[model samples]
Target: MPHSIKRIFTWIFWIFVLWAIFTSPNRAADLVLTIWEIILNGFNAIAVFFDRLLGG
Candidate 1:
């Protein structure tokens, strides 16, 4: 049940993100930065998770 809820929310989240990207007037560098932001956010989440596990 919890897994399904997570999946639904994730889908909604990504839909909104994609909408934002398409609606924005952005250059190539802006697109690159958006990609970088996504990658960085993923890395930051991983780092935070590991940091909590290791520190505790």
Candidate 2:
């Protein structure tokens, strides 16, 4: 696999994961604020990964 192709796939995979997490059923009664906080943290991880890849 080429470097550019791998980068593209990585970006796509992270975007898909983020979308999936956001679109998942909201369990308000389970833990209202915690869910969003966790999701945000996951997004932050994704951002950090991409930042490192892109030489931020």
Candidate 3:
């Protein structure tokens, strides 16, 4: 990707982040929590899979 395009995307991302922070902070926080939960659940699933594979 071109440098200009990268900068544009970075600016857009920051703008969106600031917008989320300034507007409906509670909802933004909930979104973060939901994403975190999804990541943790994925890790747990991977651990379970490995455990079963290893005959643990």
Candidates in order have lDDT scores of 0.86, 0.82, 0.96
**lDDT per residue (tens digit) for residues 1-56 in model 3:** 99999999999999998899889899989999999999999999999999999999
| Candidate 1 global CA lDDT score | 0.86
Model 3 stretches astray by more than 4 angstroms: none
Best-fitting candidate, measured by TM-score? 3
| Worst ten in a row by lDDT for model 3 | 21-30
Candidate 3 vs. truth: CA RMSD?
A: 0.8
Q: How close is candidate 2 to the true structure, as a TM-score?
A: 0.46
lDDT, candidate 1, 1-56, per-residue tens: 69999999999998977877777747645877999999999999999999999994
Top model by lDDT, which number? 3
Model 3 whole-model lDDT (C-alpha atoms): 0.96
What's model 3's TM-score?
A: 0.92
lDDT of 2 at 3: 100
> TM-scores across all candidates?
0.47, 0.46, 0.92
TM-score of 1: 0.47
Q: In each prediction, how many residue pairs overlap at the backbone (N, C-alpha, C within less than 3 A)?
A: 0, 0, 0
